[model samples]
Target: MTDAPLPVRRALISVSDKTGIVPFATFLAGLGVELVSTGGTARALREAGLAVRDVAELSGFPEILDGRVKTLVPQVHGGLLARRDDPHHMAALSAHGIGPIDLLAVNLYPFEATVAEGRGFDDCVENIDIGGPALIRAAAKNHDFVAVLTAPAHLAEVRQALMQHGGTTLALRRRLAAEAYARTAAYDAAIARWFSSANEVAFPPRVAFAGSLVQTLRYGENPHQAAAFYRTDGRAGVATAEQVQGKELSYNNIADTDAAYECVSEFDAPAIVIVKHANPCGVAVAGTLAEAWDAALRCDPVSAFGGIVAANRALDEAAAEKIAAIFTEVVIAPDATAAARAVFARKKNLRLLLAGALPDPAQPGLAYRSVSGGFLAQTRDAGRVDAASLRVVTKRAPTEAELADLVFAFRVAKHVKSNAIVYAKNRATVGIGAGQMSRVDSARIAAWKSAEAAKAAGLAEPLAKGSVVASDAFFPFADGLISAAEAGATAVIQPGGSMRDAEVITAADERGLAMVFTSMRHFRH
Candidate 1:
């Protein structure tokens, strides 16, 4: 019996990234392990002065069909699938003169990157490496005996273990195997999604995307319910869905945070949005985050209680201090300064999230909605509205400043629930009403919220009637317009696709309200 454990005597390595290949191959050679590679990997190892066997030589077949046929033959897979304990497996390997592969290092081609570059379908299809995925899956499935490395970052850990133990441990093999399977799964999902887009038809029979839960919240929309946060693989938004500080996220906390983030993401300037009950109670843009917070807070001081606040700019000491004065449930920003972090330390129950920026709106993905018996699927509403697209249907056209605020309000309203009405003045929401069965009721709720905030803030009066109003969708009747006008709204904006558009426009005109039709519906259902 030798003191050394069973070493990785035979290894097959293929990779798109060649980083650390020379040193890794040299280390393997020193261990008396036979290195087998294909194409560029073989050339690289050979140039590094290591004796590497080509896959063709081991398989006894040439790579045919423009390199697509490499590493798919029985000899390549047979070496990986053979069992060390079973006599039949051993006999089959011996009869075929094939050596068992103890280690496989493979990474798939850059299919996502290639497609992202606006490559044609043919280019994307060619970039899909079939052999690489097969090798990875085979090695991962037989991980009890074989070590499979899919990510280059794992090279150091795997190499150290191999050097120390003279063989990969079962634990390391299993961990690497999990990563290998994950890599292949994500790769195939990307391919399916791409094919679906290219062919204009659903791929994989039914479209499904996978996301791992980053955290389980304390509760759902209510404390009695349950909720969890999931981070989609390869998604760049929301700081990878992390909780940097404060208490555990509640069900309502996550929903409000999402609402706040969506509102703040609409503006390019320094902005702040305060959300309560999945609706924006206050939203504002200013020269600095502190100023924006002050303006947003001024929108609805009372309703801002226990609300979620999100800012586009870094949270500074001044802004954090202002936010701390109120009873806020959460505060999120791209980053928080050291002084800002210090302020939050006092508010132990306030959840702090630092998501750097918004996600790109054009990315393709699925949107899910749960129903009574099943779930519904549709594409995300990533559409945007431009100010120039607005048509002033009223006699009095909206001014430039009003137009800007209208656009801002429209975008914020899009994220609010149905029958949504957002009251914005100077890029700040003075009031918001959402989730009401009647559009007029939503408007009244928003107005009432603004009035309550004004009283709490000791302002002589709330925002004047000239403040803009944004509706998530078209108003079915003029009642909503009349309610907004009575509440001091001077300009209104909404998607003009409703059958009663003329009636709503007539109501706005009767009140001397400047109304614009965006021709874009933003119904959040």
Candidate 2:
């Protein structure tokens, strides 16, 4: 059976944001409902010529301790929690000289905004609302009897419901109650995350996560799953990127674009990364953005179809022309030239995003994954190693050019899913193998991909010929080491930690392969 509307006898209003409080309270007053409020809300309502009863008067206790002890009094909660249908509860409320509160319009203090502004710790502590959350929980718990309104956006809807049903329907109360609880939960999460960050706690006693919904996508990784996009409180990446052109970004497009953008941020020079299915198919750095785009495309032209491209620098007309030739899904960069924008106009379906400068890979943050019953959180993978940190484990030291290529491959390996193998020549990835179960299989797949890519390009030799290889983790056996050597890889870089490390190093020595030990792994799952 459908729920009947509940009549409103009185409402308590308090809000940090006074966007539409007066008009709402006036409407409630017009319905012969008494208006009760505190602090700024009472002042605003009374200034608007509405007869408002102060909470200090209702509780018969003035707000004390800098206005912290106002609404915690029993008079406020007793009225909200009492069920009108229960004769004993009504008698108890009447005996205490307390009137029922049928509606609550309250919004919390701007705690997240205050923290975002770089305020001091004391300022943030003060902005944490005490009475607000208490009031919201009380009203939400008694949702069957009291209507709770948490946001200013809900004001119009509540007004419409009131006007149509002559009060708030049970359905409306339940919906608003759910929204209220979500608001308080997110608020608490933000506060918890802030404390964890401020205290430099890697694994807090309790993990807290929060985000605001930016958009509701058409679907998720597949066509059937529902999905939405949310931006974190402080960080700005692809989620905050501004779309200047094209159709709406799909779930895959957003995911792939983020992968492409993050990969490009690893390079100091002008670079471009092309991603397909959340994996990097092509990555290259060159003197100019146009050259980078061309070099990256040469890595895997067949797999570049409808791929997402991200450039570290601003996109120019020359790069735009090259990207427009292909049926690409999206182009993300700091900005686009006027001529480049004109070129993209022809491909209106292509998405163009301006994400400003690349995000700092060293920034500390959490990476979360949801399991069946709980979620997992870990620090982001921001490890970096350079030539100075390289330790040559084998007898042969890598030549300077091979060292550059080894570092390049290692950086690309960091973005690929493990077990990962990357073959790079110069500053461009020649071949990539990712997400294989065994490391040896990944090595074989990389060589095979290199051969296929060479054949498709109508080249005489494989792209990985004379290229350097980078393994995301240690080579568990000598077979993986021999596979890279067999594919014409002259040098290899890996985290040297395995039970058969000596055997692998001996194989590299026999093959005359130069190997460097980073002693650091980059595993993405």
Candidate 3:
């Protein structure tokens, strides 16, 4: 009812994570505030030579059921939830010998950490705090009269406010109450997700997801929108990479860097992938990262400029020197040598990220996207094909070299946007066309790109000559296949599940091209 600061007289402190708890309680006690705590916290405060009152003593009842029913009594909630501005609330407190609790500092059990550590089910269940969330919610619901702290980070701010205003102000109480509710909500979401997984429920009737804020970006995709980054999964990649040097990464940089890293991780050999606007401009595998870079950059030199580059192995000085020669925005790898770091230091504005390790390409995970009213969730695109999985659908079978490039091109096509077309020779991409409405248009665009790259390199012939072509989905008509054949593609690989599959195979055989069908379709959007 009023915007006045309330003086703290009685404060309760209980925390599973005891970081900075003793000093915080000591500060509160110095202000002549009574300190009431529970089991381990009370013992800790007493051992620190601070006088403390136990919750059992305040409620006049002993803790039972392994301390599960300690602070759930009416005494605790009545003190936290009662409205101090009401005459009836004061009368009820006076009639029951209840003292108003002005401040509550509590942190829930380490359920998230327990699950992350792969602990046993019983241990994880035991770590779930029962009384902590109840206290937080009650205190937050009565923010006009009560203040609650959910994390140790909140202690410093509250301590500062108390020192400045001589207590917690109404504004500070409202802010802390909002944060308290958010912390509890995220905690509950983690528990719900874990339960769904443990029960083998692939798609639960009700699902919850939570994330921790990693940073606040300067802008979103453009300068007009605001955005922030959050970490939801623990898989290693751009989200978890450590920046060694350069300016702060933008939203586009993070997205493009993630795409490049995921594309590179698909290869076991030393590899490099160059991505621009979240699509792979080039990708290659070789004996060394330096060689891979050269081959990958040769795919589309014009588009490789200012692109995000990802390497599957540790970066050496040779590779770093070559990458630094180009105007690259970001370079990500598992690790870097000292000489490589020195080479990158000259380009102060180029971001260098070391991810410690590459993410597993075949690991089972979930992918989510926001829709109009809700979100869409599905399993990650981890399907892969090998030489043995290929079915020869043409008169002539592909040569050994063509077979290897077919698999390589299909893998790169998996990371490209659909309708996708990729042309690869040896182990490197020569041309890539993505996100077109018509498959024929994508094939034609890829051929044009190959010709432009060849002209830029002063070569008489385009790199797509004798290369293998891969399609992300089944070809609805034979026109796309004809385009590849006309571009001098000697072999083709695609998912065979369209109504015009017979017609397409007839066209491939007539063109004297080797074609194979992979039952799996990789349609990335």
Candidate 4:
């Protein structure tokens, strides 16, 4: 409440992440604050030439139970939780041979990291700290008298506050206490979420999800809204993707990059996917990265400008050369060859991200979206189309080549927005229309965009000619089916559950187009 600082008499320091611990302990020791630490922390401090009282010595009991029961004793918690303002609390602390612990710096065990490394369940369980959370909560609860530090990242500010105000300020203590609570809460939540997921329980009676704040962005989708990026503690994905070059990624860049990456991951072959505004502008799979990039670019070279590009394989010089000529915002791949790296180096403002490997799109996980009232959480869209589930809905059956292209477009359609239409030939997207409200309009737009893109590239023939078409959902009316046929689509694929499916299939038959219906529908919004 007051702006006054709280003087430190004694501090407890234990950390799994020892970053900047020695300097911090030395600074506190210089301030004449008695340092009490447990096990490894005590040994670390002693080795650093700083005198530290072992928790065993202070508690008058040796650490037992594999060094886990050292700091859970009443001697430590009583010192941290006692109220200095209350006479009874002070008398109780004194009667129990407990000295006041004015500060607590503790970092919990790396359970999240252990789990991420594919460690066995027993290893992960052992890494979850019990006493650490207890100490953090006790000191944080008594913030009026005790200052707490939960992470090594906060050591600098804590030490600075001590130097600036002769000790930690009440405001700083309150802030650190809030942070400490957050750390423990998120730590527990991560463990719980992991358990729930591993146990195959999608939703437990009580569920909590947590992420560590990675960075504060310049703004949200727009400049008017503030935003921050958070990532799972140790799991690596697009959220934790490292930018190897270029300017710091913007909010839109991150979103588009993720879209591109996820789309590219749908392919097993060497593939390239270009994304703009979170929609796949182009997608292609080929024998070589260079060929894939070229075919993907041919889908819509104009839209590929300033787009995010993702590839499933390591980028090669051949692919990098083609990309170097284009103005792209980001390139994401598993890795890059030396030649590729050299080629990309010329484009300093182009961000290159090495994701190590593509995240499995089929991996079961939760996806969240915020709504005005609250939020909507659902399992990720990992739908797949197989020949077993494919039905020939029209009179004309698709050829082997047509079926392959139809399947390719169908996979790409899954990444497109609602009312999506994708046209592909030779496992490469030729044109795409996404996010349209009307299904017929999407079909028409796909053809028109194909023509426009062809003209931009100085080609007289539109790329959609004789291409296979895929719709994310079934056509409600014959108009949508007729539109795709009119665009020179030789084959059509969609989930056929519409009331007017008969009319739509009849239209496809009239146009001499091979039509296949997939039982599963993928409607991305």
Candidate 5:
């Protein structure tokens, strides 16, 4: 085969992540590809003794405006955007001392990391590089003639292609261009989201967001449909969801996973939350994961079957063995031990997810719901109901232990579909009522489930008529309180923003029930 003409003569390299940069740049240099770098990258390359030219030198202008105007000039962009097939473009570039830039290795500044550190808004805004994004976009838009590299992860592949072909291939250029565009898109989305959230502005009229698929599920809700999970920048939330191991997540699996993750993320201690069909079947906190799993299992054994379980701590061997005895659909935790992995080996079909630390609760994200016309958008419910924000409205106040369970029940109930009610004796949920048309019906379902669980566990009384109850929303009428009171809920916790809050308080008082007002409503549709 005859030698192919080199497509890439000049290259501009700028990056925030410097991993493998030296080796990649060295390889490009050996191929006689001119290297132009900016700021820290230029310093690092020169210190490594590689023949490197500063971006300012190639652009024929000093980096003005505090280094923000380095690569935005025509000298840099003309090289990247010039069409190799056009003689006029080549003539213009030759006259202007601009050579066709075949390879553009560039990554933007760490805007996301700066914002995540809780830095001032001005600091984050300053970290957004203008010239970096411009160069990336220019190179990506002209992928037919230019190669773009955005991620350090692609360094090895690009090096191999360059070494094997004596230059990067057109196919590789196209692939890297796609990735470069995706990187800038996601970066822009993050900036938009951060600004909107900080300013409390509604979604922009023209909002564009992008994320990568984390995994494809076995099916969506049912075996016939399709589904997948996507994560953005490996952050928290449903979009940032990660599946450590399992058969495949379904539509219902994703829904339940969201519910399970939300509930468990609220607790700071070692806790277990068991979710079935987007409702918490059981939840518990203890000194150890094993104890937490046992207490949660004892809450509603029957409902826990094939349910999604989420824990706040690492899964231990004892907890894994206990969980293996039941037919669980999924089990998630921060981490798992080797012994725990061995125990779970017995239940090969059960999904095991190792989610690291939960995402920051304050970060904002869009909540999407499918509607008849198109879709409805709203802000995700990232609010937390803390004990300090609650008030005891009833004549009696809940004891400390009861208060702990009450708080746990409230958090669990928030993720359950409305009309929702949750019952808990210890930290574990005994029964849950969800997606009912009537609050009274939800209360009844929760009470009955708890009773059944108690009986199966051979306890004389499951809830023992003193278990706490949590309502996701305010009691619109006193009848719901009456229902929970009759169902043996000794204490009730709910958001007290309703107009008829006095009536609900009266009903609780009449039934000798302790009621606390959270001043916040958690309505999951």
Candidate 6:
């Protein structure tokens, strides 16, 4: 049986966001519904020439603690929590002169915004709405007899219900009740996150992650799995990006796009990173985005097909033209020129995203991963290596050109999967082998790919010839370094903490290759 609509004889509205309060209150008043509100809401209704009874007048108690304890009084809670079906509850409210509140409209203060604005601790603490949450919970618990409004966006539905049924349906009340509880949970989560950050607590006893639904994807990694994208209030990556054109982003598209964007952001100069299967297939830094795109694609043209491309700088017509020529899945950048956007508009199915800003590679943040029963949390890998930090292990030090390529290759390896091996020449990835079972196998695979790429480009020599090789971690054995030497790599860069470091250094010296140790490992597993 459809539950009968309950008449809204009285509504207690206290809103921090007064977007449609006046009009909504006016509508309620027109329906002969008594408008009882608190503080600024009552003042707003009165200013709009509507009758409103303040909570102070209804409770017969003055708002104390600078309005903090205004709605916390028993009269307000009793009216909200009372059950109309329960005689004892109705009798208690009547005995205390507390009329039942049929409707409640409330939105919490701007605590999240205040924290995002980098407000002081005191200011942020003051913005936490204690009374608002209590009132929302009370009304939500008694949702059987009450309708709750958590946002201004819900006003229209409530207004329509009042106009058609002269009250709210039980279904609408339950839905709004769910939304109210979710809003309070999200608000409290934001507060908890901010408090932990303020106190420098990396991992708290309890953690709550909140996200707003951005879009429901057609499918996940495959067609059988369901998926949706949710946005958190952190980072300027794919989550916060604006899609200018093309079809909606898929689950795999978003994942690869984020990987490409994060890899591209590692470089300061004009750079392009092409990612496939959430791994960087190719990466290059050049003087222009067009040049970077060409070099990056040259690394693994086969893999670059239908891959996600990311650029560190704004896209120009030249870069856009080059990227549009291929069957790319998605292209993301900080911005794009109008001419570039026009070029991309031709590709109807290609997704183009502008993130507005690039994420800071050095910024401190947390990374989370799920396991069987629990999740793992760790700080983001913001570690970087420079020329000054490099310790030459071989007798012959790397030349200035080799040093530049070494650093470049190591940065690329940081983004590559574990057992990663990257070969770089002139700040462009020549070959990359990632997520292999063995480091030696990764080196051989990278060398083989370099030769294949060279053949694809119709070059006589392999791209790894005279290039610098970088390993994400130390060489467990000398075989990996030997493989790089055989591939014609003249310099090597690795974390250099292996027990067989001496043997690896000996092998590099024997191959007449320069080797440097970063003393910092980057294992992206």
TM-score of each: 0.82, 0.90, 0.96, 0.93, 0.86, 0.97
Give the range where candidate 4 is weakest over 10 consecutive residues by summed lDDT: 232-241
For 1-525, candidate 3 gives per-residue lDDT tens digits of 788778899998889999999999999999999999999999999999999999999999999999878999888999998999899998999999999999999999999999989999999999888899999999999999888999889999989998998888999999999999988998998898888889888789988887778899999999999999888867899989999999999999999999999999999999999999999999999999999999999999999999999999999999999999989999999999999999999999999999999998898768999999999999899999999999999999999999999999999999999999999998999999999999999999999999988898899999899999999999999999999999989999999999999999999999999999999999998
lDDT of each structure? 0.83, 0.91, 0.94, 0.89, 0.82, 0.94
How badly does each model clash, as a count of residue pairs? 2, 0, 0, 0, 2, 0
Pairs clashing in candidate 1? 220-251, 465-488
lDDT of 4 by residue, 1-525 (tens): 456888888999999999999999998899899999988888899999999999889989998999768898999999999998889999998898999999999999998889878899889889989999999999999999889999887899988887888877888888999999998999999899889978999868786778788788899899999988788643335776777888888889888998999889888999999999999999999999899999999989888999999999889999999988999999999889989999999999999998887878788778888899867888999899966679998889999999999889999999999889999999999989999999889999999989988888888789898899999998999998788788889999999999999998888888899999998899997
lDDT of each residue in 76-188, candidate 2, tens digit only: 99988888888999999999999999999999999999998989999999999999999999999999899999999999998998899887889889999999998999999
Runs in model 2 deviating more than 4 A are 7-9, 22-34, 43-52, 198-200, 232-234, 243-245, 334-342
Identify the runs in model 6 with alpha carbons over 4 angstroms from their true place: none
Q: lDDT score, residue 387, model 5? A: 71
Model 5 accuracy (lDDT, Cα): 0.82
- Could you give candidate 5's per-residue lDDT for residues 423-487 as a string of tens digits? 88777777888999998889888888877887898778756367899999988899888878777
Q: Is candidate 4 or candidate 6 better by lDDT?
A: 6
| Candidate 3 worst ten-residue window by lDDT | 202-211
* RMSD in Å for model 5: 3.7
- For model 6, residues 412-486, the per-residue Cα lDDT tens digits are 999999999999999999999999999999999999999999999999999999899999999999999999999
Q: What is the clash count of model 6?
A: 0
Look at candidate 6 and tell me the lDDT of residue 459.
97
- The numbered model that scores best in TM-score is 6
